[model samples]
Target: MNNKVITKEAAAELIRDNSTICTVGMTLVSASESILSSIEKRFLDTDSPRNLTLVHAAGQSDRNRGIQHLAHPGLVKRIIGSHWGLAPKWMEMISGNQVEAYCLPQGQMVHLYSAMAAGLPGRLSPVGLNTFIDPRIEGGKMNSCTKENIVEVVKFKDKEYIFYPSIPLDTLIIRGTSADPKGNLTTDEEAMKLEVLPAVLAAKRFGARVIAQVKYLVEGGSLDPKSVVVPGDFIDNIVICDNPERDHRQTSSWYYDPAYCGKIRVSPQQETSKAPLDIRKIIGRRAVDFIKPGAIINLGTGIPNDVIGQIVKEKEMESDVTITVESGIYGGLQSGGIDFGIGRNLSAMISHQDQMLYYNGAGVDITYMGAGELDRNGNVNATRLGSQCTGAGGFIDITQNARHVVFCSTFTTKGLEIELNDGKLNIVKEGHIKKLVNTVNQISYSGKLAVEKSQKMHFVTERAVFEMTDKGIMLIEIAPGIDLEKDILQLMEFKPLISEKLKTMPMNIFTA
Candidate 1:
């Protein structure tokens, strides 16, 4: 299984025209930028694979720059990914019908790759049973151009499960922090856990070629055996990308700078507010309720950022709770909010593969995530909207395994205003649209699975608290001074089952 180690250009040559390629990266964290660049250069120089199919857990690189460049003019014909917001230009192409796009749940994509690697016919699960990902409703539909194949629906233990078939890969492209001369790779610096080895194994099992991009090369035996995530036997080609600054989370000893937020472009409809109290700080405090002492936790981007800070404020659980970022940093204190926090005490900062393996196996105790929309069935749609959405990022892997999951987001968006004063919430302006909907454009997480696993799940927003029940999603409480009809019902596309004992959330959150 000796493979060839070559330059980026040499690796790019292996990707032929009209090929079905699988790239390994979970979000902007572990993407193989150099290899993507090589592919882009080849695509621009020659008319390569006109009908290219991309299969991955996450979409393109940060901000969609890499995938955008490759799929721009006549390069890519179609794309099948869990999310595509990394590249807004591609969304434009999708909207125009110039490029085809298919959206699947992020966890489903990971399971698909796992099935492909294990030589299974496909993945069998109840994850997307009655949701949009179900074969019945467009079969994980993304746009007019792309459509997924829903193999069948079968009864198991008198329950139903939808079968999503495996799609073969012709090529697998991955990025790693370092590799040895023999092709062993490790990604200790990335944030999110990616299915790098699974991608390579799946490609190889199907007789597909594997292309890897690395930052440095070490001696054959230098990499600790325990740390080698991708062995040389599984890799077919290696491209050395010398740039080290691209990695988002570096070693704690090193001075790490947060990724530039770029431009803060809020949707015109999104309401902006400034209060004496940072809403993010309060949100972080609320997340602390989900944390348990001596538990490992994964924090998603956005509102979940507050979890780390809130957890730190308690200070008592600092030694007990281990906080990790999906970007691959483990241990220490993880700050919450957009800027993200640092881990104070340290344990082990492992690579992307190790993180995924641990999380996928349900090694984590709790995970906090932010959602764009959640439905009555408990399906989460954080990836796509009408024409724009970010990559699934690490939402799938983290939530799938965590014992307890918390999704925090405002109940409504777009000029819906609320004020907390004198221990009461005052509705300033009604939000224009409902965030909790009857159906979502995409299924990023399955509520049914949460119920099956008896996982603790909560939907926390400023206005209400809801939980998933066997019957459906149930409303447990409303914020203080919030009207059930005016604030809750008017803001939700669907009515949640309410009990006579439903209570008003305490204004003094700490006392509640």
Candidate 2:
């Protein structure tokens, strides 16, 4: 039998210069770190495989590791991915115009892998019609260096749709927990099943090399057929990484957690504590109220993810509703910080591609997302922040089709401080930056489109809450101690319509 196993260095040698490499990873959960490091080392030593284009569906870095290993200027010439906030190196390169960067919706980017696997020209959908992904606005280009138009506005049957053309793939870097002698891969110990199958298929269908990174290799027939995720016939090379502590981690911080991979089940009650009541908790407590019993929900990063998941667990609502992460985790205690994509005690796990498709189909009843900025027109900018371009991950796709969207954010940012006394919120120091701006730098969520679809929307903050109306964004709720005119209106760039019967935010939300 021909041996598919090879050294990580040998696997790195397989990649050619100027080739397009697609990887499957959600941060460091399923990251091929050993192989990626080997490739980076090879590039640094020989500079043989230079000017490569890297593609991924989700943010694949924990700021320093994962894809950041290949962020050198000459090593990567272009990057086509969903998120960049985790990888500051790529952000620096993109900001410096050293590479061509295109930021597509995370869902669309995942589906594009399937499109490439199917040998389709491109994917046509209405997911990114009016947002920044629309060619009429920016065409998903992150900088002036990005010149090619990969996304185009097309009309099908009298309706408009965004078409994302598939790029030719040359190499696929994917990870699994184990590999059999015949090269079948299984992710039984990984945090979540990423888009590995599609990435392999996309590479093999296009005659590209498939590099598989596994924690260990099993004997022939030792692996169950049902457990195999990627068959050996498609994998060109296998690189075994034995170090789970540093190289192969369940998540960035977690070396290995049985609960994260469903090897064992743990109750949410065991994982959480009574979190201190703060601005985040206040927003999360208020946002949790929007979640109706039995509603299917998607929670974005930051306040929504960090606080709301804890609130749900604290409230013991795990069985009451289904929560999904874009990383393909179904239901469990969703993690926060660098371990955002993974969860423990998951109900189910699917491919990221399939999960994105589910979200694009409007499978979510309501979605709670964080916002970077909000304009008077009700447009939300979660992409560009200051001079840095943190591409829209799955925010565009998740929010666009959800029946209802509740944006959880702070009224102000950059050193905003508050104190909770009794049931009142006292702003000690106002934030230097106003989140409510006159015009957002870029529109991640279109208000005009939301109004047209009649999607119910709400903006929840520590001090104020606003709801989207046909006329405009209307102030509906204010914190108990906040002055409507002095605290809220004066901080925003434009005046918001006030509801005649505006009420104080539930006092319970302010309590610890």
Candidate 3:
């Protein structure tokens, strides 16, 4: 067997200038940072490989790890990815019109990679219809600098679908925990194996170089066959990262945790709220009212995580619903913050693509996600907030397909304060910024589309509950002790269709 072992510098040399590189990562869980950073380092030193196009399914970091190293203005000409919350520096550049960024649904991206593996024209699906990704709504362009139409909406069988043009991809940057002498890779120690196989197959099928970064390199045939994910035939070079602790670990604050890898299940501990009850807990408390039993549910990071945490802490919906993140973990303990992609004691784990396929097929019964801004027409802007882009991770995929959808957010933001006074809610001080806007910065999810599909949608805020009607959003429920005209309607930029059967929110939700 030929030894595929090579230094990172030697591997980086293989990538030429103006190359298109596709990476696999779900928010830094299992990523090839050593290889990518090596390429970025080489580019900075030699100024070669400048103007490269980078593709990724999930946004991969918090400005310090993953693609942030490649965030240099000239290093990359364009970026195509699902989410950008983790990559803040690149987002700043995008907001400043320094680089071209294309945001796609995570499910469509995974399937597009599959299409690339099969040598197809491109992915054609309705996953992005009527949303910002729709050609009619900026065509997935993140900035004014990106003018080329990478995505187009076309009619297929009398139904409109978004078609992403296939770009000839050449270089693949991927990571695994171990690789044999022949380069068969195994990700035994990684958290979630996201976008690895499709990327490798696509790279090999297109006659591009595949560089495998691993923490351990062993002799040929030493790795178990079942453990090997990427075959040696598909891999061209192997780079061994000696210090995984420094080089490959997910984050800087902590190393590997057993709960993340499913090594052991940690029971969620019920803790009392010593701190003041904030907007998140209140929204979480109200959102749980929508969760139905025996449903396949998905929750986004941040507020959604808090909602699930509150559910578990209160011993509610413990067995009624199967919770999943876009990372493919099904019905396990939902993680929080940076470790948002994995689960503990996973009842099942599917490839992120497979999970997405299920979601795009309308397999999800319900979903609870967060939003940054909302318009009178019920459109949502969850990704961008006045140039701060938190790319739509699975926002389009989940909201577009789920049978029932709930968007959680405070009625307003920026210095928002609330007081819980003996089973009644009080807005101690109103927030200066109203999230109920005249028009969202970007339409991540289309309310018009949701109504067309006959989907049940609800907007849950700290003090109000809203529903989507045929015409527009209707105020259906207001929290107790909150005035209608003075508090709710006065705060919103536009008056909504008020429900004649308007009711007060359950006071038990606020009594704590």
Candidate 4:
């Protein structure tokens, strides 16, 4: 194996048309942006690949950089990964029938690629059983409207397991801090401790090419052998990016710094809008009823984003409460403030993975997430709604591990009318449709698992609040100004069991 270094352009040329490529990175972190830009430039300069299949545990860099330049405009045909939100262009491509997008479970995706790298037949896990990802539902179905690949139930020793096939890789693109002339690499500080080494090894074992983008090229024997993550023996080409700015905080070798923000800079514009209360705000405020003092909470994007505002306004809990994001950021009170605060003293910045590992270990006492569609069986589909589907992001990990989970959204979207006057929400016009459905197109997180784990779960909307019980979804409360029969009952796909002690949510939530 030669330890030769090349230009980023040369590395891009190694990727041929119609090849299966695996990108190494999680959302917004450790993506090889320089290499991705080079690929985009190459595609623009020459004939682009057709029917290219991208395989990865997550589409971190490809979606953000590659999709806009090459992958989305019909240049690429197939995408197999866990989530799709990081790349807006790729989502559009999938929706337009220009590409085939297959969604896989997060943990299962990691296991699948690891399995392939190890020369295994496939991966067997209990993650996707009884959900839409189940093969029985759609055989991991993929279409313009749907993205999930079905999970198959295989009974071994009378114990059921979901089987996910191993997918071989033709090329692996990874980013690291530095590479020795001998090709030894290190990712000691990278975000997720991603299986980049195994991915590169998988490609190498299959006689495929491995391309690595690094900030610098060191002497042949410069890098400590023990510190090397992917040795030169496995790497085929090394591209020197030279831009230390891009490499420093991204490679994960550097200590997590408060000054280093990602490509998307935190700005006031991106902050969740705060104004007069609407149906969404009403639902968010009502979710506060579930919060307890001294609880650690994780807030998902969307309606749940509004909960922080309500919490701050209400001052409902003691000062011991903590709030976190799914990205693994913690102690950041993000209550529609001028800037999202972080840590004590409102530090507003923290290491990303630290938050993920915390939630992964079920450190969060409660979690609030937004949902697109939910069923009587308590399955929630927040990933895809109509023509819009955001990646699961950290929804699965947060909801699965949180002690209590709350799904917050309006009873129906699209022209739903509700107004706030005198600090109270008044439903003027109920949206003529229901967001709660008989079945969800995809199950982003399993409510059954929440029940089995004895975790409390609630589906809270402007119209009603339903709790998952041993029997099923039970109506626990309705909003202050909602009509129980006309608004809540008629809109639900299935009849919700009304609790004998159902009550109206408090209007003066700030005082509650």
Candidate 5:
């Protein structure tokens, strides 16, 4: 038998110091946890592979499980990631300027891998234009220590675009569901294909060593040809995790669920548990009213993923309105929070690279997302709010291209209280932190760009709904039993443009 399989420690030894290593995962799905843990242990024991660079598209940690294992100061010198909310330890390191960091759009990061595979100079797109990712702004730099420019501006045919230069990869650490004796990998048991294919291709192009971790190893010819995701010829080492239930979980919350991997289809009734009537439900109820029949929509993580999805299912509009998740899932109920990126009863599952192409090219009809901060210029700060930095995970790509944008958030955060009685809203206590401000700390969604493209933009809260117009945000509707001046205007940091024909939000939305 050809010896292509190795232990996780042996695979960890393949990495060299100061080399660029890229990984593939979304939260906890397909995270290669055994490999990551081994690498961390090897570094701690010998301190051999120090000052390495880590690159990942999605946030690949459940606080301390996945990539957070390498959060030691010398283990990683630089991090090129799309999101940072989950990796709290690395967030602290980046905040303290202990490591240099640069954040890029998640879609563009996947596209970068493809470009690297093709040996292209860079990947060009309009995904980050006019946002903080544009070089004119922060250039996706996270700390004062990061000096190199990874994102650039270029003009093509008199139009502007953001160019992400390809960074040479030295090592690829990826995960899969199974592997054959010859090293061919398959993802039949994984929830998402993620960016493992492009990552391997990129590593092969750069002559980088590829180390893959899988849950199972089978005979060479037993696996079907079409099931192979990465050919054995492209991989250098394969590690079969001994304890998959702990290290190779399907998601952060579950060890393995056949429904997540499309092995078994679940009923819509089982997936759709009605959310209790609350502020989020009210905001979701109001937001869903804007969707037309046959409209394809994208749902983001927070309120949009949970509340709006529940409302859509409760309304039985799954057949009428198509729902797509950024994780390349189509026509399935998306799980919320840490269990995100996996779903049940999925109609189709495509690679994230291809799914991003659809989002960047033709785009969706509308996208309902959550917002962290909103300013007077209509810019949103979903990535960075105060000291909490959650990098834009496809938020920039989705919101920038979508024809219509609706941001669902509470009027304030931290500690706010409200009551719903007899189809009216009463603010018992205002939130300590106001989300609406004069200027957002970071721009995740450019309100000016939305207005420039004539895209419809709406901000829905429990109390009121505001529309982004040519002038600014205009108060178009207010909830019943709410005082316009005390509960609405006084709570905001800036006064908004009140519509001449302001009306009350439909009372039915407040009903159970």
Candidate 6:
């Protein structure tokens, strides 16, 4: 076996100028930090590897690490990924017109890697039809600098589908838990084994150099056959890192927790027991009412993340329902902040590809997602609105499949204020922006399609609750102390069908 061990600096030097590189992870979990950090260091020090394209199926890291480390203006020429919400520096580069960005559906990007690994020309699907990813629209272009059309909308038997042509990958950088002397990789202690196999094989199939970073070293054949995920034959080089416990997990705040890696079983733990107080907490309590034991639930990022955590802490139903983040953590203490999309005492960790397949195939029972703006027809904008290009990460894949959906949001945003007095809500001041609009600026969730499929749809807010009815959204519940005509009808852009059995939301959700 050729000597595979290498220094981080040497690994960084392997990347050539103007080569396309592919990465892994979403919102911090399973991201390649050591290599990305080294690459960033190399570029900043010597300005080599300029004009390189970065490819990822999902957002690799937050502002501090992962792909965010390589956000320099000239180092990256283009980026093809599903989400950029976590990479603020890269977003800034796109905002400054110094980098080209293209955002596609997370599922499509993952499948495209599989296609590449299989030596296929490109991946074909109807996932991006009628959405911004279609060529007729922005064509997956996120910034002004991206000139090439990455997606094409083609017709098949009177049906329209999108085709994502695979690009030649020059290098692949991935991080795993261990490697034998021959470079067989294992994810024994990682938070997630996210697309390691696909990314490695995809790069190798295309004659690209594959570099891996590992936490520990092992002698040849010391690693269990089943434990070794990526074969040593394909890995070109390996970099063993010491003290991976320092910066390897999702965030610096957390060391490795056995629960997150599925090494331990999960039991009900009291996260919180207080009644919902904040507006998001109120919405979460309402969403909890929809929860049924043993049902699989996927929580969207940002605010919906809070809703689920508040419910788990307040109700201590950690074991009642199976909770999954889009990044593939399940049954642990779902947290927020920089540690979003991770489970503290998780039941299992999986790859983003498997989760996407489950989502696209309707394996999820229901999804609780955050919405920025919603139209009267129940169309929710989870991604971009107007010039703000908050790329739809897994939003399209999760919503397009799971027929039963509950969208959570405040009745208003920006400067909305309310008073909760004796379990009664009083609107002190309305937000400058109304979340319920006449028409959504973007179609992240199709209420019309949901209605056509007879999917159950519910919208939960601190002030009001609505359900999809044949005649459009029907107001079903309102918070106590809120006037039906003034607070509910006057606030919305259009009138909804008032439910014949209109009732007030539960007081238990408000008072401690």
Clashing pairs counted in every model = 22, 0, 1, 13, 0, 4
lDDT of 6: 0.80
lDDT (tens digit, per residue) of candidate 4 on 90-206: 667766777777766555665465577788878886556655566776544446444545456899989777888777678888877678876788764444345566677667767
Alpha-carbon TM-score of each model against the true structure: 0.78, 0.98, 0.96, 0.77, 0.98, 0.92
**Per-residue lDDT for 1-512 in model 6, tens only?**
66799988888999999999988766776666777888899988898879999988877766677788889988998988887777778777776778888888988788788898999988888676656677886787877778889778787898777888988999988878888878898988776667889888789888998888887888887888998889999898998775576557745346676666767655655343453468878888898788887788889887678667667655767667888877777775676756666666666777878878888876588888888877878788877655566678888888777857889998888898988999899999888887888987677777777877688889999989999877899899999999988877877898888889999898877886
Model 4 collision count: 13
For residues 1-512, write the lDDT of model 3, one tens digit per residue: 48988888888888877889888877677766777788889988988778989888888875578888788888899999888887888889899898899898888888888898888988889888888898887888889989988888888789888998666778888888889888899988777867789878877778888888888888888988998888998888889986788778854344577666667776545332332356787788888778767877888887987556546546556678788888888776666676677766778777788888888895588888899888999898998888787788888988899998899999998888888888788888889888998999999989998888899999999899999989899999999989999889999999999999999999887876
Off by over 4 Å in 5: none
| Cα lDDT over the full model 1 | 0.68
Q: For residue 345, what is the lDDT in candidate 3?
A: 73
- Model 5 lDDT tens row, 1-512: 36588998888888898999999999889899999999999988998799999999988988878999989999999999998788899888888899998989999999988998999987989899899899899999988899988888999999999999888889989888888877888999899978788988988888998888999989878888899999988888899999999999999988988998889987655676678999999999999999999998999888998877778888989888988889999877789887777788888999988889888888899899999888888999999877667789989999999989999999999889888889999888888999999999898999989989998999999999999999999999999999999988998999999999999999989888
RMSD of each: 6.7, 1.2, 2.0, 5.6, 1.2, 2.5
Per-residue error (Å), model 4, residue 227: 7.4
Candidate 1, after superposition: displacement of residue 76 in Å? 2.3
After the best TM-score superposition of candidate 4, give how far the Cα of residue 464 lies from its true spot, in angstroms: 2.6
* Candidates ranked, most accurate by lDDT first: 5, 2, 3, 6, 1, 4
Candidate 6 RMSD computed on C-alpha atoms after optimal superposition onto the true structure = 2.5
True-vs-predicted CA distance for residue 336, candidate 1, Å: 7.1
Give the Cα error of residue 41 in candidate 2, in Å.
1.0
lDDT of 1 by residue, 84-191 (tens): 655677667777778766666566676677788899998776555545566775576566756546456778899887776888889888877678877898765444
lDDT of 2 by residue, 1-512 (tens): 45788988899999899899988888777889999999999988998799999988899899989999999999999999988888899889998999999999999888887888898998999988889899999999999989988889988899999999988889989999899877888989988888888888878778988888888888888998898998889888889985768898878988888988888998645776777888899999999998888998998988877888789888889778899888888887788878887887888988788888899995599899999999888999999888788889999999999999999999999999999898999999999999999899999999999999999999999999999999999999999999988899999999999999999998988886
